[model samples]
Target chain A: MQKEVMFAGFGGQGILLSAKLLAHAAMNQGAEVMWIPSYGPEMRGGTAYCTVIVSDRLIGSPIVKNPTHLVAMNRPSLEKFAPVVKSDGVVMINSSLIPVRSGRDDVDELIVPANDAAIEVGSVRCANIIAVAAFAARSKMVDLEILRECVKSQFASKAKLIPLNMAAFDKGLELAEGK
Target chain B: MAKVLMKGNEAIGEAAIRAGCLNYFAYPITPQSEVAEYLAKRLPEAGGTFVQGESEVAVGYMIFGAAACGERVMTTSSSPGVSLMSEAISYIAGARCPAVFVNIMRGGPGLGGILPSQGDYFQATKGGGHGDYHMLVMAPDGVQEAVEMTMQAFPLAEKYRGPVMIMGDGMIGQMMEPVEFPEDLYVPPTNKDEWATNGMDTRKSDTKNIVKSLYLDPTVLNDHNLLLKSQYDRMKEEEVRFENYNTDGDYQALIVSYGTMSRVCKTAIDEMKAQGLEIGMVRPKTLFPFPEKAIHDAASKPGCKVVVSIEMSMGQMVEDVERVVKGKTPVQWYGQCGGEVPTPQKVMEHIQSLLNS
Candidate 1:
């Protein structure tokens, strides 16, 4: 099975990192994965996004026009991408900041209070991690163990921050499970 | 061989190292500056030379000096800087010096932009410098090809006794992909005592071997040009490479593209196929020894109504397409110059419009 996922948010929302982590996890699972970022001048404060494609076969196109899943960390991302999700596709929305729900009924929508959940975990910045956990739980595209391995590998060089990030990931998984 | 994730620019640098290129001289330019930066650290570890020359002009001359000593040498730059080095490139060609020059092409007519573009098609294939010479140009679409072609360029240059160009765009330079270095590849040390001007006593003959492009006599210049033309003719016979996609069936449209632009075309072809539009793509893997026969064959196809030349330039390779098509088919051109890449949707639209018309 081939799946395309887009994670989009403001520049500081860790959207690119989250997409990379997903790609890394997919790679660890022996899936062919490609992570492409919105490069060039649009990379300033403007809404940044990355498209990750995980496929059991060779990936033909890296650019995804219609994604199978979307992790919308902010309102603009939801507004921009809600309509493009495939039928029965999962969209994990950060409801703490986005007031409205997806207008499309053809797809599955999960409204997790990502920001509020992060705050409960003592850091609002871990909202992306929360969204990632929700995506893993809903899609099962990658195993939680592989995701944890990706998180560890990402923070391996910085041993001090590993505990906090691991805690953040576990907290995210817990929040998704509770939902 | 094991795979390692590497950027295109860094892979070129590593490939150059594996190809036994001991000397590298370059000035920084976007999309390709990473090659210079990478070699600066990697070269010393491999016991090679890496110099950030004062300017592109100086770097070109430094390449000339190193190449004259029979050392495996290389240099890299983007559009404008490449333009600056053209003079030296011409000199190198005329002097029959073997070296590798990589242009990680960015947009251009003059300082156009820093984004990736295939605008240098004419500049690269038609000889950017002032001379009746041709550099063996290889256009790599992916990262693996980029590394492989670059490693192959060094020996090819030596065999041809001329410059070889690894022409790629910003995407191929900046994008990260998996690459595997050749297992047996290693840099061979140059025998400095052979042709090098290190000391007079070590020379084979008392007379000096002058490596100059200047031949004042018209007859001598004519002979030199004829010799270079023959080399190019031989290159055309041996060096053309292209990849054909979905060309077996009758195609309504024939798409010709190269470098990063071809990747976009592949996406467009897939999309068009879903919509029931029969399209075929001829992606040139080498620009100079262009697949003229392949282009001609595609154009000569009975159902192939239009030949669309998609490029990142304002219609440079279109001229070559026209030449090959020779008025048998309507050769059309679509391009976005100065680092703007064409989208698959846009290309599909162009093809669809042509099919409808």
Candidate 2:
């Protein structure tokens, strides 16, 4: 089986980083993974997106017309990508920024207040971590423990941000599990 | 070694290092600039020299100079940058120096766009530079293959005593995938004392080695061209590499594609197989010294009705496919250019319509 997860948001929201973290986690777990970024003429608030494809078998195509999941960190991202997500796939909406729903009944929609969660955890930058954690928890695509370790190492160079990001991760898991 | 997830551009840089190529010169371009960025930091750690030239034109000559001295050398660039470097490539080919040139292709003609494109098919296979010279071109479908091809290109260049090119699309440069560098593939630089100006005293000989591409005498230039032709002929006999998919079955149509375009074709083939349509594909790993016999035999298969050359360009490789097939079967071209990769669904639809008609 193959699952493609698209992360879309503003440039500084760490969309590419979170997607890369997820791909790294999947690779560490012995799964074939590909992380494809939308590159070219990108600005801070303009728009940015990336796609992570995880698979059991060798992956063939990096381009996906419809991904299995969507993590929309902003209203534009939600509006742009939510329509193409497959039925029964998870569509996680950052309710903190997006006000509308996906309006699809067949798929799993998880409302994640990622920005608020990141603010509560002491840094708004960790909102991407929150959304990624919540999506991973709900989708169960990768081992949560492995994902946590990957996140830890991603911030290992930074050192001090580890605790804050870990708190954000746990809160995301808690919120996702509660749902 | 442990598997690491890395972007294709950075992996190629590390692969060159693994192959013991210490000298690198390049100018930054989108989708492929990461290679220069990567080597700038890593080459020093490996006791190698990394220089970013003032422009791509200068970078080309830098590679030529290093290779003429028998140093393992390389440069990475996009389509337009490669255009500026073509003159040097021809000079290097004429001088018989070994070098590696990697083109992480983007949209073309001019500065089209910074997205994945295979529009350089003709340019790579049919001599981007002047004269009857061709760089041994290899197109990789994914990051792992890109790493392997980059590592292998050094030895291949040395073996043929000419330039080798690793032709990849922007997606191959930007995408990150898991890759492992096998220790067995590393080859130490070959002995170039015979032709390289590594110095007469260093070789303990009174004779000096001179490297030049200018042949003023007509007969001597003809002989030089013939010598280069012989090497290319040998490559056609030995260096042609390709991969077959679903060809064992009596497929109705044959697809010829390369690089990232072939991967999408594979997906389309898989989907078609599920729907009981037995389509096959011949993916050329080496664009130059292309698999002529393989394509001919696949096209001549009794059940094959049509052969399609699917590419990112409108119809470049199709001309080669037509030449190879020789009218045994109808050949068609299908593609999208300017950074828009054709989807598997669209490919399947087009093939299904072709078969029906």
Candidate 3:
């Protein structure tokens, strides 16, 4: 099995974290994975992003040109990356922030209000976690339980923060499942 | 082996410590700065020393000083920084002070951008310094391989009693992957009393181990160069490392590459395989004592037609490939410079045109 996922958003939105969570879960499940960020001066600000590739076999190139799953957490990310997703791939656009739809008819597009969902649950910083849950549920690329545990481990050093992140993850999962 | 995820740069740093290296001196450079950053904390914890040199030039001498004392010393830098370290590298070579250095390469004719490129192939395998020298060069593709090579570099340097380099591009230094470092590869080096310049106290007898490269005598300098050449010849015989993929089949095309470019070529080969095109790849793990015979053998496969050298440079390694192919099969070159890695699609298009023409 092989899947390429790209998580794109503003620098502070934890795009790198959500992608790291998926990459960690894939490794925990015994798959070869690589996580490459949009490194260079472009990373100083503006649209920050990272790509995670998980495969049962050796991954040839980590710098992917077209990802199978695209998680656009903002309007700029959607506008830039939506058309590049594979024809049969899955895309999750943050409906609360990005109002534009990925006009591709061949792919599955899930409009997730991750920002509103995170705020409804607890913290605004949990928006990336919500997108992670939505992508996990929609693509079925990784086990949902594994993804949740990966998310919780991100806050492992801060014991008091786990419960809030879990609540945010559940709210996002619920939204994706209902759609 | 417990697998943990880590960036390539950080993993290389951790692997050096695990390999029993104790001294590190480096200056910060993009893409490879994480190596120094990671080593700063871990080296202290492991009872090792980590120094951020005032400049790349200073770090080069710092490693030479530590290595002169028989420590498994190391330094890391990108292309531009490596240029600054070249003079010291030549001294370390001439003096035969064993040290490990990593060059996570970036594009460069001069201060080219900080993105992944393999333009340093010639500078690395051929000599970046102003002397006749050969650094045991290991080019790794993934984080796991990078760790293995970093671990092996120390022993290789000590064995040959010269400089060793782990050559990789910015991608290999920046990308993250799951890596399990080998527990048994951590080898403590042998006693350096035979050649290393410890203090007058360390030498039991009156014989002083003066580590200096200045052989003003013409006969003495020639003898020293001949000694270095002899070790390189042995490394070429015993230390050559490479791997082949799908080469057993009746292949019509063979591609020679190393590090990240080889990985992309594998992707292109896989795509071509699905369409019933047979293309094999030879990834040279060691770029210096570069698996020449292996290239000749792979290119001489029953159905092999053309041999192509794919790289991120403006076609540097192609010269070495041609030297090995020796008019057996037509040697071709494909490359892109200035930090731009040739994508799989682009490589495939280029290879297809080569085949069709």
Clash pairs, model 3 backbone: none
Q: In model 2, which regions exceed 4 Å deviation?
A: A41-45, B204-206
lDDT for each residue of candidate 2 in B23-128, tens digit (9 for 90 to 100): 9999999979999999999999999999999999999999999998889999999999999999999999999999999999999779998899998888888988
Off by over 4 Å in 3: B200-206
Q: Tens digits of per-residue lDDT for model 2 on A1-179?
A: 99999999988899999999899999999999999999966533479999999999999888998999999999999998889999999999999999999988989999999999899989999999999999999999999999999999999999999999999999899879865
Ranking by DockQ: 2, 3, 1
Q: Show the lowest summed lDDT stretch of 10 residues, model 3 chain B.
A: B199-208
**What are the root-mean-square deviations of the candidates from the true structure over C-alphas?**
3.4, 1.2, 1.4
Candidate 1 structure quality by residue, lDDT tens digits, B83-168: 99999999999988888999999877798777888888888889899978899999988788899898888877776678899899
DockQ of candidates 1 onward, in order?
A: 0.31, 0.86, 0.78
Chain A TM-score vs. truth, each candidate? 0.94, 0.96, 0.96
Candidate 2 whole-model C-alpha lDDT, 0 to 1 = 0.93
TM-score of candidate 1 relative to the true fold: 0.87
- iRMSD in angstroms, per model: 2.6, 0.7, 0.8
Task: Report the CAPRI category for model 2.
Answer: high
lDDT at A168, model 1: 78
Residue A165 local lDDT, model 2: 90
